[model samples]
Target: MNGMWTFLALMMMISAQLQAQFDRSPWSFGLLGGMQRTHFTGTFQSLPGLYNCCKGFDGSSTSMDPFFGGSIRYAITASFGLDMQVEYVQSRGELSAVNTIGNALSFNGSGFDIVEAQSAFMMSWTIPSLGFTPSLAWKPFESGFGIRGGFTLRLQSNGEATGREELIQPKGVVFSDTKSTIRNDRKVNFTPTSLVYGPIIGLCYDMKLSESFTLTPEISYMHILNQLIEFSNSDESLSMSALRAGIMLSYTAFTPARLVEIPITPLPIIEIDTNKPYIPKRLKAKLAAFSVNEQSKEENIVNIVIEEYSSLTMTPLLNFVFFEEGEDKIPARYARLDATDTPMFDIDFIHTPNHVETYLHILNIIGKRMIEKPASIITLTGCNADIQKEKGDMALSMRRAESVKAYLEKVWNVSSNRITIKNRNLPEKHANTQTIMGAQENRRVEITSNEPYIISPIITLDTVRTMNPPIVRFRPQVETDSVSTWQLIAGQQDKELRRFTGEEKVPAFIDWHIGEEMSEGLATDSAIVYAFKARTSLQDSAEIQGMIPIEQVTLHKKKINRVQDREVNTFSLVLFDVRSSEITEGNAQIIEFIKGFVKPNSNISITGFTDRLGDADANQRLAQERADATAKALQVKNKAIVLGKGNSALYDERYPEGRLYTRTVDVIVDTRIDN
Candidate 1:
């Protein structure tokens, strides 16, 4: 018995090591029918102090009986279950004993005494019972092997024990052998135990036959703890044990379904103000322009220098189109051209002085380039921000690249075979990922081409003019709680020379370049008036006017004085990755180029600028560090003017590329010709 328990414990440990593989139902009904082998044990005597034939007999019997039952199992979990089974079982066994005592003569008419040799007694009984078993079942393995343990309750029906006594004589003795039935097959005189209980341990293996059906083979051993019958005359009793083997076929009734929870947001409450009129907020605007010329001492007056020269303007193109976080489609800010509009799209016609505006037509520009260079192939590598909603979103990145690819294929008639699309978490050369602007810049698609001109700088020849005050800085201030719309218009007489508009709060400073068109218009006017208008959402409006004096040199006066024609050259070194002052090899090469353009009479000005990020003081320090580094790298003989402009919006700060372009040190060299 100890060995049996040891074996059972070992099986449990092995089963626990395996993983559950089958999906079991909660409720199952099964029919079980099998054979039970009962072993009976005890010491019994038919008659206590009577003949030695039935005295001091070791009682033992073994019988096999068929039992049929039904069981119901409820699975509490994937591995645990409760089982109940009821069956009708029968226990049948026979006990026989033979012994020889003192010889006895059989009563006969003859004078000879016959010696009785051996006496024997044979007994057989049958007990029918109704058995109920409730057990806890555990299935710990994916192999469908399980174990169950419980107690069995049996209620016995009317049962009886019958016995026959026999006497055997020697051959020499003429006494006839005597045989008589001592007990009939009727009910026994002593009452049997009506109720029996014992512990039962079983093992079973489940074989899944179908989706809702399973067949299991089981074997169990039960030992009755209490005696079945006790001899009234002696201190001896009879007990029985059973080993049952059977198979059960079960059908699943139903399995519970898992429920998913969804959260619902409640609607917000709104109140209407019908008792009072809507009063608009008061709005006020201020406007001023700072001179960039060293000759002009006043802030409102700017000296202009117009020179005639055929120059090639090479605008280096940024090969990335940025996207919003968690978005795959192209933003509306980028200009999209249809197939019908492709013929009318001309890169040469785009003459905006702002390079960012020209960058808005990047797709059209690429398409036009592809049309011109048919052998060129390009790859679009999409990237995600790798944080927040966009973290490790490779699918979204691929979709963004595909979006660009689809636009090119559909609108530009570019062959799909020429374009290759790829995706990754972030670009190879990405910006700082810790900041919001940095993450925004990282979420973009990079365009690379095998042909150089396809992505090279856009070059155009135009009549270039140099201004004494190269930059006209506009300072606009608006006093309003909320600004719905604002516009600053710089005009010359009846014509609008330049206009800047915004929906958000007005920036502290807006810089306007003295381009060819603006310089021509400003040459005729002594002063340029700028009008500032602002309004709130409630239609409360304010307008202000400001004038900047212009020191203009007329064409006839320049011819009389034989004024020397001065040429201006500007070079920019953009720092994209970090805010450090360390100059890279590429920046060193640009510095060498700027050094080559510097003549003895050339006035060199190096201005360092930073984006609208971080503290103003810190930016100022960083900008100064960057400018000093560039000046040291130039190693020029003449002293150069170096200034650090901190967070002064040189370009539109709303775009990532604009922010990147703002973090730069620009070298402008103005040299006069002696003719």
Candidate 2:
């Protein structure tokens, strides 16, 4: 009993621990399949009344058997659940005793006797988790496996029993009745009702059947803490065990079914009249220019109805306006126009001019707007004005388009090449006395591509040497009014910045030299100009990280200082390593870092060094190898430099901490030419 409580408490702790790791639902069904072993324990309250010696016998020997069972589960979510199971098991036990008192007066049995018992049984089980259950499968790698444990209450145990028992009642009276007898009992109760607690290890397989339905199969084992069965003759006890397995089919339904919504009906269309004395206010402003060449006004009353637009004069306006109060032309405000945030005459159409006159006329209005808003696209539509117009002919109206183009370039200073002259290709209905008053209304112009008001690019400037050339930066435009800035933010990774833009710049050629001779003695070398940019906060921190090993060309090198700081042949290397000396790894990081530094023609210098661990000769060899290795890593199609200082004293002995300071690489940049 004590062990049972301890095991139950332990299971509770484990369940609670697992519950906190995931999200669990209110109810869950699990299928179980496992084995169980059992042992029997307990004292008998009373023995058979016919047997005097069996009254206080101790059951010294016990036996157990394996069984199969299953459980149904209802979870309250993450912390607790209710469980039920049924099992079929068979068990055996032994008892021994001697008729010590019955042997008096020489009427006694000489030896002690043993009784054996065997039982076949079935039990109903109910268990509740002491702690909450998990809501979700926490370990994906577990492949839908979890652990559960709690205490169980055996509700009912029902089964048949058949066993043989021998008894020694008295020596002389009917000794035959004391012999072993086969007895059969039905529905015998074998186990006591008590809390059976143990650890539960299970695997949960959640099979998605559809959007709402899920099929879960699980197998678990429960270790009983105390023996469930009691001997009919003694107080001795042992642990009881049972096995269970089951499967359940379940379903789920969600509300508010998804479907497509009906679309709203369109508004009714409206018509207009240009010849009417009082024009509809909405259609008048959209017409930029229109004139009625009426030979006789008495009978030829042209009624015009045009569409309304924000700008570009394509809608209702001058072309469809009626002359009221003897006005030569209609004012934009008087015309019925579409009320919009954009004002009249403020719209510009970008065009390539084929007709100069109309082009210029339109440019004047657009250029004035450009002066006010430099970042606006200008559009034009029309042909030369000198072309003759035949009655009811559309193509003839565009012949004089050159006048529009010429006027725009000469007076408004609009580029003639930029102007576009496309004929309106007017259909009679769009212009028939209702839409357009006459031929003039059929000719027109528009503005296109606006440039300016874009955000500046973020620049990353990296240098092999501060003495070399400067870095160059640029950006591309895809369309009007849309621009993304190029910047390197602190601590932001380079790949993250690259997601926004695709350009990067890196330092030029890097060089490495050993001493001064080609094969022996002293050697010197240099690298060509390269490009570079600095890491943005997003790319990395501003504080120096590790060194980057670069290719020779990336780090340009030139002999600037002597071997001993005295006047000597000097070389410059552009791309070189920074914190890391591992030429390969460092080079990879450097190259990736350069992806966001898209600039051009950045000349840098490279200077390589080594630690004083070895002799001058060994140190020189190591330093040259390090520099050369770094240089080869950064070599791209672009010009880069490599420089190697063969242990000619770069760092002092005071910084003998490691190669960190002793084995150092530096870059110098020069900014003069453009590459």
The 0-to-1 C-alpha lDDT of every candidate, in the order given, reads 0.78, 0.34
What would the TM-scores of all predictions be? 0.44, 0.26
RMSD of each: 28.3, 40.4
Which residue pairs collide in model 1, if any? Answer: none
Model 1: lowest-lDDT 10 consecutive positions: 178-187
What lDDT is reached at residue 333 by model 2? 26
Q: Please list the residue runs of candidate 2 whose C-alpha ends up more than 4 Å from where it truly belongs after superposition.
A: 1-146, 156-195, 209-215, 230-235, 241-248, 251-675
lDDT for model 1, on a 0 to 1 scale?
0.78
Best by lDDT: 1
Once superposed on the true structure, which residue ranges of model 1 sit more than 4 Å away at CA?
Answer: 1-314, 459-461, 464-518, 522-563, 584-596
For 575-636, candidate 1 gives per-residue lDDT tens digits of 43477888976576567666777788878888888987988899998888888888888875
Model 1 TM-score (2 dp): 0.44
